[model samples]
Target: MPDYGFERIGKRLFAEHLVGGNFGNMSVRDGDAGFFIKKTGAYLDAPGEPVFVPFEGPVPKDASSEYRVHLAVYRTTPYRAIVHAHPPYAVAASLVTDEIRPLDSEGEMFCPTIPVTTGAPGTQGLANAVAEEMRHNKLVIARGHGTFAAGATLDEAFLLTSLAEHACKVIALKKMFLQ
Candidate 1:
């Protein structure tokens, strides 16, 4: 039932190009046991079915490659949902700064400052870096990759992804033609 939210979020992500191909993953806490994650290689726009993964033992073989990243955040934070996406503008911003300072009003209020991390995707180093940043920031950009965002719900997490990208777009635009 809760996984339905991911379906909607996924579709939106695809439509807005927040994620393309099989480049993103999402999950929602399903109690203390574990959480429900999108299947590996599943398209966010229309992920066919959900996979319920537990916290105790080994991760399912079919789970997304970034499952470790999602688990790490849930283990250390109160956030119940996570969204990982390769937003073009955000990734571009990461190449230029350690922190993304929001230019838009909504972005300034919601995202404020987004930290950037560097590491190979699905590595503990990357996961730990993201979890560490989540201590004070809900959204963090993984340099040369994308964003790792967490929130009370999938929609909230998704909003951070969108906001980060939008803010980065503004920054990029200003630096380009506006300058």
Candidate 2:
């Protein structure tokens, strides 16, 4: 019933250039057992395979490096899916600002204010920071790293991921050409 469209969303992430090579990850909660996450080193376009991780236990050796962030979100938020990516514009904007207030309409309505937080990449600290904000925001940016977005389904999460990038792109462009 839940849209576990990992492969479909993965392809879109790749086709749209939101991710390049093996730069991002995705996951879906697997009831009380655990969650299924994209494997480390796997390409978003193909998404080699998904690794299952329990709510409490040793993680799979091949799980995505950002697995902790995904796990934390699943445990702390009501969202059922997550999509993480290093979209260029969003990552670039995050470098200079502590928060991103979308200059565009859709970003204004859907996201509006996305908090930018920081922690070393692939650590529990980063996971905690991201999960904490995701509880109150649709998406959170990790300083100069990437984005962590959650939704009831992968489709919804994927859309947020794209929206963040588009909105950030607008901000970046306007700042470059208009400001």
Candidate 3:
């Protein structure tokens, strides 16, 4: 069965232009078992066919390498959903700083101070990095990767991701003016 909440999350991500092509993933917790994440290689456009792998045991073999990041956030925070994306401005901001400090209310509200995680794909190292950073805030940058946001529901997660991207874009434009 299709998880309607997740499908809506995917659609919202697409609407925000946070996801382009097949780049990005989102997940929602599955009660006590774990979480259900989008399958590897699934794009936002094909929400109906999106994979919903259960994370009951270890991360599923076909789970997105970024799944560890989601697991880490959910484990460390009260978050029930996560949205990770390569939003151009946010990814650009991540690459520019080893740390991202919120320069506006949007950032202050959802992220405040964001940490940059370390590790190769699918490794616990990145998860640990995110976990440590998330102890202080709900958002973190994945170094060369992308941005991640977690919340109590898919809508909240998606909203935070959108806010983060918007904040990043505004910050980038402000920097341009300063230059």
Candidate 4:
């Protein structure tokens, strides 16, 4: 398994409050071989080693449960790294809207529109939805689940993931203030 910047990104995810405990996962593409993913239930903040999963054959039991989404994404898009995080504001925003239109300038520029996709966690349905969206958009939020951001590298993907939470947090606060 390669660094692909997971250690740094993992720390950001935890510090930014995008994920709690071991709820989120990440991966980096490995060409024809497969991908290097966080092990199931591994702490993102201090993930020691990553597990590899091949394109064919059985997936390792220890692989993150969300590996299916990562595999589907790599198979369909040119992105090299994928970050899946359960951003509180993003998930809360997804619960009420079909999409998130950021009010902040940075959000508007980098992630002006984040579509909320629907599918159960760790299922093929979720994988397909996220993969298809990732083909065109770098960031997507599974309804009430989390945010999935794809990029050329883990750093890039991590940026999108962070931006997503920032955008959603602003939107949520705005809505709350207005109400």
lDDT of each: 0.89, 0.90, 0.74, 0.91
Candidate 4 versus the native: TM-score?
0.96
Q: Residue 167's C-alpha lDDT in candidate 3?
A: 81
lDDT of 1 at 42: 91
Model 2, 16-41: lDDT tens digits are: 88999889999999898789998998
lDDT of 4 by residue, 57-115 (tens): 89999999999999999999888899999999999899999989999999999888999
Q: Give per-model TM-scores.
A: 0.96, 0.95, 0.86, 0.96
Q: Which ten residues in a row have the lowest lDDT in candidate 3?
A: 47-56
RMSD (Å) of each candidate, 1 decimal: 1.2, 1.6, 2.3, 1.1
Indicate whether candidate 2 or candidate 4 has the larger TM-score.
4
lDDT, candidate 1, 82-147, per-residue tens? 999999999988998899998899988877888998879888888888888888889999998999
Candidate 3: tens digits of C-alpha lDDT, residues 51-105: 4455455556667767877777777777787888878787788777877776888
Q: State in Å the error of residue 163, model 4.
A: 0.7
| Model 3: residue 156 alpha-carbon error in angstroms | 0.9
Candidate 1 segments exceeding 4 Å error:
none
Candidate 3 local lDDT, residue 147: 70
